[model samples]
Structure formats: structure tokens, C-alpha cells
Target: MKEQLVFATNNPHKIEEIRRQLGDRYTFRSLQDIGCTEDIPETETTLEGNARLKARHVKSNYGQDCFSEDSGLEVAALGNAPGVDTAHYAGPQRDAEENNTKLLSELGDRKDRLARFRTVICLIQGDTETLFEGVCEGRIATSPVGHGGFGYDPVFVPTEGDGRTFAQMKQDEKVRISHRGRAIAKLQEYLKSRSGADRPTG
Candidate 1:
């Protein structure tokens, strides 16, 4: 496995989660550790595009093996209103509470609360990029349920689970099937098959 890999993100929660999943087998560093706090425009129209855009930017800027992810909460009733713009759904200045509230408001009067959390992770080394995707199907609860996870976790009740919101599940429990977890699993498989020092690959 690569000794050190960069994840192009600034969210500590996300970094912690990924580290917990990947563990000491590989060191996971973020934008701050690599001195890349500059704004990278997410001008892409799809999750895969945004993820690759971030990963490519980090690879070019830091000249290292970098990975990035773009995730979104898409509600079937809302016509996927917050797809790629999930982070900024509430407006230019995004707030989790605002975004969640807006989602609930828009979903009002709709009996079908179908929704899915989609995540796309892009692993990049120079011009080579590999994509892994995961989706968790669930329904939006009438109101927030727990205080554990972040973002829309409080309202997302997984279809395969015991009706508990993701925020209500323990970190380990959530990591078992969360979109990020699945993506990380795929990445681990790739790394295990190609274990080596961090050298430039043509």
C-alpha cells in the first residue's frame, strides 16, 4: 500500500472517518497537511467530475498521489434538487441546518420520502484516475432523529437498517455501510493489489 496519500478535503470529520477505516496501513493526509488550502473551483456538473477535478488539482499542485470525493443527498421527490450542490444547497453561504431545513420544506406534502446519499471517490496519480462509487438508499424522516453524525445523517434512515437514522448509529456501525465506507473499501482493494512506495507511476 502507498505509505502516504493525500485526500483533497478540509473536513476533519471526513478525514477522521477515512483514517479510521483505512487505519495505519496507509497514512491519510489532507489539504492542510500538504499546504493546499487554496480554493479549487468545483465547476463540474457531476459528482465524478467534481471529485476528479479536486484530485487532479491536488496532484498537479502537490505532485503526489492524491484522492478526493464529492458526495450529495438526492431526494427523489425533490427531483434531486441537491445533487452536486449538496454542500451549497442552502445558498452561497452553506449551513447544514439551513440545507436540511430547506430539504424538509421542499419535501413537504410528498408521501414518498425516497432519497439516497451518493458518494464518488477519485483516486489519482498523474494522469491515471480510478473511480469508486457508493449509494445508500433511504428515506427522509419527518424530523431529525439523532445527534451523532453530521450533515443529513439525522434525517437519513437507511432502507436496509432497523429504521434508525445514521446519526443514531455508532461510528463503527455507520462505517460498515455508509457511502464513504463502501468507497473506502474499494480503494483499499486497489491499494492492496498494488502495494509499493510512493513513486511516480507512468
Candidate 2:
């Protein structure tokens, strides 16, 4: 039987992306799957901190092997203004279109559009906590492009691609080089070393 791996998230896009990358390595569970109906607070000021916060919450309440990820877009020209606050860059509403507009307005005529997406994943099992990080260097597009991804995908162009925004690429193409994918890859490596890293070590 596949081991239960609690994936602490309510976002279906993220859950699907991660599940695809994870393959058949383990059985995945999410917030809805586990009846965690409330919006978990992410009161931290940093990506890693928020990731840990979510993971810790799941472990405390569910007593299960769980993991959480936090990611953001860092634009070099804006001094990384939206690092940890990428999700709420527009305001507390966390509207994606507004956030994108706000980012574009802040980046008006900056000339240097270089940026990157960074993701941090925190995994918890019992008292053990582990962190994995990944970064995908890229540039912010002049405008949103494509219709494939969520969040900043419409405006982010990875360095490994042919100048198309992340939203322009297929899921398989994007996951192979995404920051989240890279971070999860590291976690998978660690999991492999620790007996395939799944819950119910039963």
C-alpha cells in the first residue's frame, strides 16, 4: 500500500502540480482531504518561515507526516520588493490580477527586468523538521503571457526557456524547471534516503 503523505494545502493548482511531480511515490492528502477547513495563518515574514508555519500546524493538529511550500517572485530591479509578500503585493485582498498590476506599476521603466522565483518546502514527521529550497532564475515579462499557470506564472519567464512566460509552457515543461519542482526534487532525494519518505511508517 502507498504510504500516506499529507500535503498541507488548499490550492488545487499547487496540489495538482506537486502531485504530478511526486508521481506514485506516496498517497497524497490535502487540507480538504483531511477536513482542515480553516485558512491556516501564514503570519511569518519570510518564505521559509511561512512554509514551516504551515507544516508545523498540520503536524500538530493531525499528527501526520506533512509538508508545506512557500514561494515568491523576487525582481532584482524592484529590490525584491515582493519577496515574501508576493501573494499580497496588491493588498490584503491577495488578488492575482491586482497583484500583477501592482508589480507592473512598481516596475515601470526599470529597464532591468531580471527576476527569479524561489520556493522553500518544509517537511515534518514527528519531531523532525527538514527544509528544502530551490530557485529558478528568470526575468519578469513586459506583460502577462500565456494561460497555463497560476500566480506570477503569467508574468515570469524562466531562464531555461525560449523567452516564453511560464503560463505559456505546458505543465510538464514548467515543472521540470520550476523552483517548486527543484525544491520538491531535493525533498524526494531526502525521502529516498529515509525509506521513501511517506507517512504511516507502518
Candidate 3:
């Protein structure tokens, strides 16, 4: 039987991305899958804190092993103003387009387009907690470039890529170097080690 783990999120995009990266090694259950309908509060001021907060909430409330991640786009010109508030950068509505627009507007005509996407993941299991972090150095585009990725993907270009926004790249391509992908990779490594140790040896 596959190990069942809960992912503390209802966003289909994030779920899909993570599932693709991790493959079939383990079964994942989203917040909705576990019948959690309440809007979980992310009152923390940092990405790592928010990830831990969500994971803890799910583990405590539902009595399940779970993991949660929080990602943000930190721009140099803006002094990383929208670090923790990446989702609701524009308003409380959490509109991606509005957030992108506000980001561009605030960074108007600024030569320094340096930015980076950061992801922090928190995993909770059986009284043990672990955290993993990933970062993708890049720059913000002058305008939205593609229609593929969610959130700031359309406006952010990875430094190692061919100058295309993440939204413009294929799913597999993006996952290989994305902030979430890197963080998930670390989590995957840790889980694999744990699974191996838990197995009965001959």
C-alpha cells in the first residue's frame, strides 16, 4: 500500500505541479480531499512560518501526516515588499493579474529587475517536523509573457533559462528548476530515506 500523506492546499495548480514531480511513490490528499473546507489562516509573516503553520493545522485538526509549502517572488527594486504577501499583493481578493500589474507598476522603469522565487516546505509526521527550502534566481519581465503557469510565473524569468517566463516553458521543463520543484526534491529525498528505514529487512 502506498503511504498516504496530506497536502495542505486546495489550489489545483500547486497540487498538480507537486504530483507530477513526486510521481506515484506516495498518495497525496489535499485539504479538500480530507473534507477541510475552512479557509486556513496563514497569519505568519514569513514563508517558512506559513508553511509550518498550515502543516501543523492539518496534522492537529485532522490527525494526519501532512506537508505544506509557501512560495513568494522577492524583487530587488521593490525591496522585496511583497515577500509574505505575494498572493494578496494587490488586495485581499488574491487576483494574480492584479498582483502582477501592481508589481510592474511599482517597478516602473527600474533598471534593476533582479528577483527570485523562493519556496519553503514544512512536513509534519508522528511528532517530527522538517523544513526544506528552494530558491530560483531570476528577473521580472516587463509584462506578462505567457498563459501557462499560475501566479507570478508569467512575469518571472529564471536566470538559467532561455529568457522565457516560467509560464512559457513546458511543465517538465519548469518543474526541473522551479523553486517548488527544488524544495519538493529535498522533501522527496527525505521521504525516501525514511521509507527505506521503515521497511522490514530480511
Candidate 4:
């Protein structure tokens, strides 16, 4: 029997991305899979706190080995103003287009458009709690370029990528160099080290 691991998220896009990246090494469960229809509050002021908050909540409620990830975009020019508030940058509505428009306006015609995407993943199982982080250095594009990814993907161009927004790339290509992708790679490494396996079994 495959070991079950609960991924703390209700977003179908994120679920799909995680599933695609992790493959079939273990049986993955989402919030909906276990009937958790409520919103996991991300009230923390930082990414790590939010990730841990969700992970601990799920483990406490469902008593399962689970993990949660928080991601954000930080612009250098804005002194990372939207570091943790990237989701609701515009207002409480958290509209993606409004957020994008706000970001562009704030960064209007700036020569230094440097920015980066950061992700933090918190894993909790039994009494063990571990945190993994990943950073993707890139710059903000002048406008939303593609319609592929979620959040700030439309206006973010990775330094390592071929001058295209993450939203313009394929899922495989995006995950290969994305902050979430890198953080997940670290998670996989840590799990492999803990279990001496190729991929995470649970």
C-alpha cells in the first residue's frame, strides 16, 4: 500500500503542480480529498509562519503527516513591499488582475525592475517539524505576458529563463526553475535523506 501524505492546499492549480512535480512516488491527498472545505487562514506575517500554521493545523485536525507551502514575490525597487502581502496587495479582494495592475503601477517606468519569488515549505509528522525554502531570482516584466500561471506569474520573468514570464512557459519548464519547484526539490532531498529512498514514499 502506498503511504498517504496530505498536502495542505485547496487550490486545484497548486495541487496539479505539486502532483506533476512529485510524480507517483506516494499517494497525495489534498484538503478536499479529506473533506476540509474551510479556508486555512494565512494570518501570519511571514511565509514560514503561514506554512507552519497550516501544516500544524492539518496535522492536529486530521492526524496525518502533512505539509504546507507559502510563496510570494518581492520587488527590489519597492524594498520588497509585497513580500508577504503579495496575495492581497491590492485589497482584501485579492484579485489577481488588480494585484498585477497595482504592482506595475508602483513600479512604473523604473529602470531597476529586479525581483524574486520566494517559497517556504513546512513539513510536520509526528513530533518532527522541518522547513525548506527556495528563491528564484528574476525581474518583473513591464506587463502581464502570458496566461499560463497563477498569481504574479504573468508579470514575472525569471533570470534563468529565456526572457519569458513564468506564465508563458510549460508546466514542466516553469516548475524546473520556479521557487516552489526549488523548495520542493529540497523537501524531496530531506525526505530521501530521512528514509534513504529515491523519492518521498509518504
Q: Judging by TM-score against the true structure, name the best candidate.
A: 3
- Candidate 3, residue 168: CA error in Å? 0.5
TM-score of each: 0.93, 0.94, 0.98, 0.93
Candidate 3 structure lDDT: 0.94
Query: Per-residue lDDT for 144-193 in model 3, tens only?
Result: 99999899999999999999999999999999999999999999999999
Candidate order (lDDT): 3, 4, 2, 1
Candidate 1, residue 9: lDDT: 95
Which residue pairs in candidate 1 collide?
Answer: 1-195
- Per-model C-alpha lDDT, please? 0.89, 0.90, 0.94, 0.91
Clashes of each: 1, 0, 0, 0
- Tens-place lDDT per residue, model 2, 55-156, is 998888877779999998999998887999988899999898899989988998778999999999999977889999999999988889998899989999
Local error of candidate 4 at residue 201 (angstroms)? 17
Best by lDDT: 3
> For residues 1-202, could you state the per-residue lDDT of candidate 1 as single tens digits?
5588888999988998999999887787889999997989999999999999999998887897899999999899888869999988998787888888988888886899999999999998667899999888899999888999898898899987899999999999998889888888999888877665455577
Residue 129, model 4, lDDT:
99
Error at 166, model 2, angstroms: 0.2
Model 4 weakest 10-residue run by lDDT: 192-201
Give the Å error, residue 172, model 3.
0.5
In terms of lDDT, the poorest run of 10 residues in model 2 is 193-202
